[model samples]
Target: MLVGLRAMLCIVSIVAALPAHAGTLAFPSTGSMPVLSFSATVSAGRDTAPGTALSQAFGNAGLAVSGTDCTITQDISVNGTLVPGYTNVYQTGVPGIGVRFYITAGWNGGWTDASSSQFNKTDGGTAHYTRADLVVTGPVGGGTTSNLPSMFIKFTGSCIETVTATQTLTGSTSVTGNGCSLTTPTLAFTLPRAFSKNLPSIGATTGDTTLSLGLNCPAGVKVGITVTDAVNPANRSSSLSLAPGSSAAGVGVQIVNGATLVSFGPDSAVAGTVNQWIAGTSAGGAMQVPLTARYVRTSSKLVPGSVNGKATFTMSYQ
Candidate 1:
């Protein structure tokens, strides 16, 4: 009787263990999901003239758009297979991704317009203006046990808008002497390193450190200047006297070294006719002169300290 009872108790114990093993077969599998994130920026190509609209003002300045508008996406997956001897199974989920863009616009007082005669009118040109916008989208996310997850339907691409302009001049003048001269001048400008925020190489150490001026003039006239840094040879030129009707003039500057060229202060020029036109009623008429400048840097090493530079202009008639 004792042996039979002991056998029955063993069988009961076996039945309990079978239920525990069967419960393991019903365990659920693991899973994973993808992740996603997004940003944008706006840039201008150059300075604009005053009175121009925001959209039309871009080309006036040399500011250009740089960078993209988008977001990030991530995803993950889990495998259901487990070792026969192990009871615990681990799983993960997919990640998400996305992107967007933004733009900023403003004035940069770093340019000027100078003419030869005071009677000739001068108009204050526009400062720099920039524009940026944002775009957002969703991307595909997927992964598996045998393959690494990938952004299957990723969002990507870019768009560009160019800026442009046209300028005109008009007026009349009178000359008491043989030669007549007019000067229409404005201030020169300087830009800080912060203006070039998008370019990584254009940091505090190697920022755009130089400004240039382009002067356009008529034949026989002379244009000269005194600068803190060495000016480009091509920028210096001869100025011309206004004919009885109208004429055009131009000049320019190229900033050198580690420093940048700022705007020109108030300036003027002298005018007198030479041998032939002395006693005649030589009416000096209306003329237009345009001046423009830009910033650039050399490929030399950036020093660890700050420095200073300057430029001055003076004109006289013979």
Candidate 2:
């Protein structure tokens, strides 16, 4: 009877130990298992207003100003299933993932103003002006970060700004002495009061007046321009006062484009000739005209460079 009781106790103890051993085998006992995944998105943010005279002028000119904005978002996921031999692990074994987001912004602006005025038959005037600006903003060295794995991460970055300005002028004048009888008038050119005479100057009394033009480009951009006269000098004349019965007649100033004459008129005229030629009355007039040039980019490179060219004007008296 005692032996049987001992055997029964041993069997029960063995059965209890078997269950414990099976539980240990089903659970992971080695290293921790980690699984991670992450995703992010970047976008532009709102632009700030640029404060300057140039900005104000552009606004007055009906130009709408704009700037780029920046934004960033991130998501992270983690799972505790990366290890082998793990089956009955606890549901809360894995840790939550963390992430962060950041952003940056910058801006620039510029402009040019031009004007021309004719004073008399012997003098004229022209002027040009330009300006620019740039700006940047943000935390200089640090950015924001988020810790929540499921939420988007955001951070503000450093910003940059810049600006610039410029001015220019060109003027000319001409006079005819022989009234309407003469076919050409003496020409005079002047430089801006601030410009040095070391630059090229016009010395011809009767000929075409050529105006040199130049431009400064924006960063990463370049420009080039070509200008040609649209009128012929011989076919055009400037009108002037003339006495009745006088033979004086001709165009005053002429602008030519290729072989075609685009603009021409008389500046003065006389009624008669000298020494057996009937002396006629005299009339005088003057004009101020504005001209334009076209620019085109010849290369695809983004490096900036200046573009320069010239336009010609002819004055004729007959």
Candidate 3:
């Protein structure tokens, strides 16, 4: 059984990348550029008024949406003429590259091509937004050099009641449009009020807590997890332990699936999988995999210090 000083539980997340095919949504319109990269700009706070514009650009700040009302202006541009239709750049996907931005997890309200400025020269186009995510396509109208266009990325959506992964940014980006899943950079389990508890007999019974993982992917996507060997890999059995500098003594954390201790192989290996799940269609809503973390008692007496462990969750997409 597990014991702790306080009653806090921190979930360790490690998403495995299992690439599959949903369809094709790549950039350049013609060829496939897998090594594409671009930084996003949320020029306003997530709490800004519904339709008002913010003063400046909040470069690469993460976003959290309550509904589809929290509004903001955003500018997403690639490094070079990545944005089709810049100068004589015609749309490879359509006519002139209008751009189609795909998001991880999902979004609340929906995005619209904020066409008020004379700079928004695209005569017509499409900016698609769903409860799952957003995609800005088109501007396949005529001649233009305006690569980076302004967008109205509002957070007023009606998908889930709380902050699910479908509405959070996972910092994972691709030049290709859609098809793959979108994820948040990290799934931080709330800080436990206390990390201390009573110690149960080894190989006996103890305590456990439930946790959530944020993943928004296409239909039929599979997920896997892994843990690093930063701790004592040889001394431990099938579970992982706390790294150096933990407050609790003779204690560690282990992920459990039912009764078995989930084996988290080396740091970044995705082959020897342990805990995993598949994403259902949108009819079922977003997929935030529920997991359990328990305190592993290694010492005879329950200490009065904290019991915390750290592991980097590297989310991979197929």
- Give the CA lDDT, 0 to 100, for residue 51 in model 1: 20
Give residue 166's error in model 3 in angstroms. 50
Off by over 4 Å in 1: 1-186, 192-283, 303-309, 316-318
Give per-candidate clash totals: 82, 56, 32
Candidate with the greatest lDDT versus the true structure = 3
Can you tell me which runs of candidate 3 are displaced by over 4 Å?
A: 1-184, 190-197, 229-238, 258-260, 272-285, 316-318
Residue-level lDDT tens digits of model 2 in 131-236: 1111112101112212212111111211111111111111111111121212222222321222112212221112234432222221221111112222332223
Best-to-worst ranking by TM-score: 3, 1, 2
lDDT of 2: 0.20
lDDT of 3 at 86: 35
lDDT of the candidates, in the order given: 0.23, 0.20, 0.36
Please give, for residues 13-132, the per-residue lDDT of candidate 1 as tens digits: 444343211111000111111121111122111111112111111222222223322221111112233222322221112111111111112224332221111111112332322221
Looking at model 2, which ten-residue stretch has the lowest summed lDDT?
Answer: 52-61
**Model 2 ranges with Cα > 4 A deviation:** 1-283, 298-303
Question: What digit string (tens of lDDT, one per residue) describes model 3 on residues 104-172?
Answer: 222222333232111111112222232112122231122222333222232211232222112122232
